[model samples]
Target: MSSKRDLIIQAAKQTFLKQGFEATSMDELALVANVARRTIYNQFDSKEELFNAVIIDIWKNVKPYRPEQNDEAQHNPSKGLFNLGMAIANYWSPPIVRSFLKLVIVEGDRFPDLPRNFYRLGKEPMIQSIFDYLTQMKHSHLLKIDDIGLATQQFIGMINEPLIGLGLIILSDEPDMQRKEHVVQAAVQCFINGYQP
Candidate 1:
């Protein structure tokens, strides 16, 4: 059983994904949610608040990378790095996420906080996870990195650009397993070459 707030959030997410933030209306959300318009207002002060909730909901739903949960990653730095890259790629590969990203890119000026909120909630944590892993690898002497943060950013850019630029932004064909493997492996190898002692 879903709570009224959950129902409203789910309904709004679907509407926003399909119609985008600028186009979606509170009335349409009310109709889709099967709740009175005032009900939404009772929960959220305004449409922006509702949209922010939806973005936070979506970010929450995306599987977070918890390296502590994976013992294998703790022991194997190379495998861990590859897994981190793959996790980011998988997170961004979802249609809903891609739709939200497109909406943010298109309407960022209208709602200036949308992109910042999304990055703070969604992207920052992922980067932090990778940074933590890199820090562990450095402590173990598996890699010699003077600046783990810069390396984390570079590694993410390497993996993200090819998949996101071609596959998502340019509307290229979905990358197959072979392509993903190659990209992840290449990213890990490049990171290792740069940092490995």
Candidate 2:
């Protein structure tokens, strides 16, 4: 059973992804959600707020690595990084997430804050999680990372550019498990080679 709020958010996500923010209407969202328009107002004051909620809702489901929760990240840099890489690859490779990203990019010019909010609330936290994990590894002397920010971006780029970035531009088949593992492994090895103390 879905709560009215959940239903509204789900409807908003699909609608916003399919239609840009300016084009999407509260009435349409209510129709798709199978709720009255007032139900949306009860949950969110405005479309902008609902849009932020949609981004927040998506990230809420994502389980990013936390150093306290995952001790493996502290002791084994390679294994931890591979897990991180796979998580990033898997999350972004999905059609829904990609579509949401495309929506933000396309609508960014008209709704200037859309992309910023998306990044600040959604991607920034994920990036910061990785950055924090890498900082922990550095502090533990597990990896010799002088510049945590650059290293974090490098590892993420290695996984994302080949796997997700390419898909964003051209129609392409999703990489199989073997290919994903290869990319993660190569990234982990390259990171280890450069940063290992």
Candidate 3:
């Protein structure tokens, strides 16, 4: 069975996704969660805290990278980068993430921490992971990257633009797997062409 906290977070995710942060009320959350209003206060001090918890919950789908343990990254930079790009593309191309991003854009002025926490917890770590992977590749003499940070950002930008940015701003449907593959492959190819020793 689900714990009360889990139930509350789940309810909050659905509610916040539907009604957004400003419009959602603790009383409605309690009712939706099938718990008392006090139960919510017991679990989360305020609605903002609960909303942050929902963001954290949503980010749980993002798997962290440990470059040291990744043989593919160590031995094969092209394959590894393509794999990483695909992972990033798949994660951010969904409707839930798109909706959450829209919510952040809408409410970031009122709750500044929303976008900060979103990037800090989600994008920063992923970027850092890619940075570390690039550092590893450079050290191993697999790739000749002079600036790992810029390369990491460039690689990520390449994948994120078509997969996430287009859909978030103008496109309505998610890019198909073939499109994702093409984007990642092109990113890896361009990165390798630029950085290969």
- What does the lDDT read for residue 77 in candidate 1? 76
Q: Which stretches of candidate 1 lie over 4 Å from their true place?
A: 171-173
Error of 1 at 40 (Å): 0.7
List, in order, the clash count of every candidate structure: 0, 0, 0
Residue 194 lDDT, candidate 1, scale 0-100: 89
Q: Write the per-residue lDDT of candidate 3 for residues 34-132, one digit (tens) a residue.
A: 999999999999887887788888888777555567776679988788778887887786577778888888899999988888887777888888888
What are the runs in model 2 whose C-alpha is more than 4 Å off?
none
Quote the lDDT for 106 in model 2. 86
Pick by TM-score: which candidate is best?
Answer: 3
Pairs in steric clash, model 3: none
**Model-by-model lDDT, in order?**
0.85, 0.85, 0.85
Q: Cα deviation of 82 in candidate 2 (Å)? A: 1.5
Which regions of candidate 3 fall more than 4 Å away from where they truly are? none
Q: Which of the two candidates, 1 or 3, achieves a greater TM-score against the reference?
A: 3
TM-scores for candidates 1 onward, in order: 0.87, 0.89, 0.90
